[model samples]
Target: MDMAKDLRGRKALTARPLRLAAATATAGLLLTLAACQDGGADRADDGQASIVAPGRPGEKSRTLTPEQAAKAKPDDSPNAADQSYVQRMIEHHRQALTMSALAPERAAADPVKRLAERISAAQKPEIGAMQKWLALHPAPTAGSGTTAPGHGHDHDHGSMPGMATEQQLKELADARGADFDRLFLKLMTAHHEGALTMAGEALAGGNNPAVEEMANEVVATQSAEIHRMRAMG
Candidate 1:
């Protein structure tokens, strides 16, 4: 009976690791297979970008025509899942930009100001990238930039996580000196954490290389920022 118990324990331990491995492998595969068809746009590529899906050893090559390729380009209304990821990240980074803009005026420590500067530098371009992707992308409607990445999200655009309401932003803008620094740190930290959550979700469910790469970068960079904000807080 003791020997039987040991065998069962070993099997359980082995099975646990296998399950985790399976999950990780499945996630990697999904990212590699990124493809989306809006229930509506029904359009293929708009005109420019093309995704050359990596070749498997034996499969015949598949290439999308310019029109079909254009269809794959990022759109404002990313699927409910992809939109959730994109929208929340955009809002999170917007707050960081606000915090960074305030640094010149209120941050007492050069380090805090420097961190804010870095945050602004990094996120501004990324914001443009994401926004441009959304613009080029075809959607069922205009101005519907709200892809969630993985989960079929249904949150109101106005109430996404990491987004500060108009009133909250106005309050932040009104702050001065150490008050600005304190609120900025606190808010940015929360914002960074929210981005991490969205990125993690994308890593688990997203397929597009562009989307996956962006999500991975968000996870690593924002994670570092969380530590930076904590130290500076």
Candidate 2:
């Protein structure tokens, strides 16, 4: 009788922890899902989905190729805007990785650091993909590599919205504690906004599938993140 009672007691002990664990897991799942849902999507004043996030005061659209520089229609040919978007986005994405790499040291909190790291991780591969596309469709230089239009950009400004200006980056480098947090949020927010601008233009004008895919991704992810950052603030 004692042995049977001991066995039953052990089963009860094991079952109790399992039951508690299940309940805890369920609660956690509910909370996480709730957070995701509450984050919500951005809508314009007119109720359109805001593909571009909110911007700071200094935002500007980087110049694109003019119409005369473009290919003769889209029938089996890449256009000038398409080529410029790919090349510039590749450069733009590289800068994102650069900024993301600095986030942990500059971030004020675990969440900010993680978000920056995530952005960096996601953009690195995209940089490589864009480079690959360019390699396959070489800029029409001395005619060696595959040729594309508007092969040269005069400024290479890295002009996207969320991008850290040299001065802002310096501020980020010098910041610590809450200062770091605020600067990071402000800088990254602007950086993301700039990417959204580029993406929006691409969606409206570019014809490449890869270009469209990256543009859509930028819109969706940045839109969600803008809300998350706003909530965090």
Candidate 3:
């Protein structure tokens, strides 16, 4: 009986280390997960944030200090070009919405009405996105020869490419039936062309990835719509 008791005690002692090793591993895993949740960075015992920068292909990732991470970060901040593009595009889209609004009441062709609906549906959400982006990343204070990027603050809508003249808009508003259909298709086609030009300029000058993505979407969507309009015409 004493021998059996001694063996049992040995087994318990052997299991303790295994259980302790498992607990330590679990704690380490939890710490690693906590670090990942904290923005791909880990906090040291001293409470300093440490960045985990991934290396090139076939290379191992290494830790970096905050200063190093900042230095390594790409210069993707929104520039004046980005701000201007977004601000102007918002106005541009509003004009498109205005034209589209007229279609439901005046358009004679089913295709024209459908096209107008599509334009409104696509552009409204885009306007919301751009507005949200602008709100999130406010423009810098105005300086010499520059204006703050606010709605209608400094931009002249008439001067923007593809914007219909006030006379043209008035004409569109007055027209009905086939006249409205012809005019809407013509004006929207031109407006989309203008959007393409603006997007190209943004792609060339803007530094922010968000601006680039928005510009690319404009180019792609407008280009397709332009083709469809041409075929319709």
Candidate 4:
């Protein structure tokens, strides 16, 4: 009887360790499964949709979820194209203003006079807005001279697409009545088309949101003006 009881006790001790080992393995497996589930949840939470994130200096760009990208600051910094377009466009508008200035006294047709008045009215405010924008966002002066290449104060009239020559302006200024109307419409049409070209370039190349908005407005307004001028002829 004593031998049987000792045998039974040893068997029970052995069974306990086996049960303990099984329990430990089961607990470890449960922990591992829980960690895997948590990792998947984290990935799901980060957002499923991926977006291209611009890289930092010396870093390669990486794909990110919209949620992750939203954490980053927005970049609407003006590019060189934006600056050039704004500066050149200001000069461009000034020429239009000069042309329109002659219309009230020189233009014979009522329609021509009214068109010139509208152009002047629209452009004057646009000039103010562009001037304000330039003031707000000044060009970098590093390594640049007193007058930057695309500075608002200074521009290359020859480089601009639609600018009238000295002789053309002289002709317009000297002419009166029907002659003035004809010349003005023709010159203004070419001028507006040139503006459209500039605006299109700005839209394609510029980075600044404000510049983009300005360029789009120019395109819309000038396109309408072009149609009107063509219709007048």
Candidate 5:
């Protein structure tokens, strides 16, 4: 009976170790599974998406993750395209204002004068906005020289599409009554069209959200004006 009891005790000891090892293995497996589940949940929480852009010939494609493409803060710096667009547009609008100023005294038609008034009202505020944007941004030295208020006269009129030549401006300044009305309509129509072209370019190339919004506004407002001008003629 003593031998039998000793044998039973040894067997019990061996079985206890095996049971403990089994429990340890089971716990380890559960922990591993839990870690994997947590990792998946974290990735889901990140809310990141990806975009793949096609590469040029012989080049690898690029991917933009959500973190990279996320909307920028308002104070984010402007790009070259944004600066150029703002500067050029400010000058463009200034010239339009100059032409519009003439309408009160020179234009014969009420509709023409009203159109001029609308153009002036719209562009003056836009010029101010662009000026403020430029003040905040402060372009590089090369681009900076062009940004002075009322300094648009220094620009080469030939470079800007639809800009009135010095001679044409002189003629507009000299003309009166019906001639002035006709000339103003033609010149303003072309000017607005040029503005549309510039705004479209800015929208395509500019990275700044504020500049893009302004460019879009320019496109919409000037498009409507263009239609009105066409109808008036």
Candidate 6:
């Protein structure tokens, strides 16, 4: 009886290890299957492939998904109103720069000279920005060849409102001392008003977001400058 008991005890111990091993293997397999299912779900949630899209000629490239690309609008292709604003504003800003350039020699008051400098500084950068925008979307007049560097086009200068006539510019150029200051302020104020008019038109009719942003900036800055120039006078 004792020998039979020992054999049965050993057999029970051996069977216990086999059962534990089987349970551990089953648990491991279940855990592996669970992990695989979670990984598959994660992949499904983020399955869209990334693609690089080209921007406007001078602009940086952007990344988008297939869905985003499908919904995206082509804002870079400028409309007729946008092109008109750019072309006209370029000439307008150039004339302002011409007026501002006379300030150092012609303006008598220190404040007037400083104001002219400020105007020149502000408009130069804006002119460059507009020119760059134009370069990206060339005008119909622009041949297949590269567009010229500055606002050197043959557009009619008198067509824009608030521009000083040739007689007025000549008068401003010839004036001196306190006379120059008063005339400078007056002419610049008129020029700024014209810019406001153009900007308002752009806001109403222009289609490009960039042009609209520029117009809004012109309205704000030129409006403030107009008030300041009036106060100076």
Off by over 4 Å in 3: 1-66, 144-152
Question: What is candidate 1's lDDT per residue for 166-228, written digit by digit as tens?
Answer: 776677778877887787888777777667666666555444446656876776677777788
Candidate 6 ranges beyond 4 A from true positions: 1-76, 141-155
Clashing pairs in 3: none
lDDT of 3 by residue, 1-233 (tens): 23223333543443334334544544444455467676765777777777666554586866756566556545567878888899899999999999999998999999999999999999999999999999988866556445445433477878889999999999999999999988989999999988887877776666777887897788767877888888888
**Winner of 3 and 6 under lDDT:** 3
lDDT tens digits, residue span 26-51, model 2: 44444443443476434446653322
Model 6: how far is 25 from its true place, Å?
Answer: 52
Query: lDDT tens string, model 5, 1-233?
Result: 23223333543443434334544544444444355456632232356434333344586844444344232112335666687788789878988998999999998999999999999989899999989988887776645654444323344546766677778888888989999988988999888888877776666556676887788778778878888888888
Residue range 1-233, candidate 4, lDDT tens digits: 33223333543443434334544544444444455456632243545544444344486755555455445434557867788888888889999999999999999999999999999999999999999998998875656653335644456776799889999999999999999999999999999888887877776666677987787788778878887888997
Compared with the true structure, all predictions reach lDDT values of 0.61, 0.61, 0.78, 0.75, 0.70, 0.72
Model 6: lDDT equals: 0.72
Q: What's model 5's lDDT at 78? A: 69
Which window of 10 residues has the lowest lDDT sum in candidate 1?
Answer: 35-44
* TM-score attained by model 5: 0.63
lDDT of 6 by residue, 1-233 (tens): 23223333543443434334544544444444455456532222377444445444476855555455445533334566677788899889999999999989988899899899989889999999999998887776555343343333665679787899999999999999899999999999989888877776665655566887787678767877887898999
Model 6 residue 53 distance off true place after TM-score fit, in angstroms: 20
Per-prediction tally of clashes: 23, 6, 0, 0, 0, 0
Per-candidate RMSD, Å: 13.3, 24.6, 20.0, 26.9, 26.8, 27.8
Ranking by TM-score: 3, 4, 6, 5, 2, 1
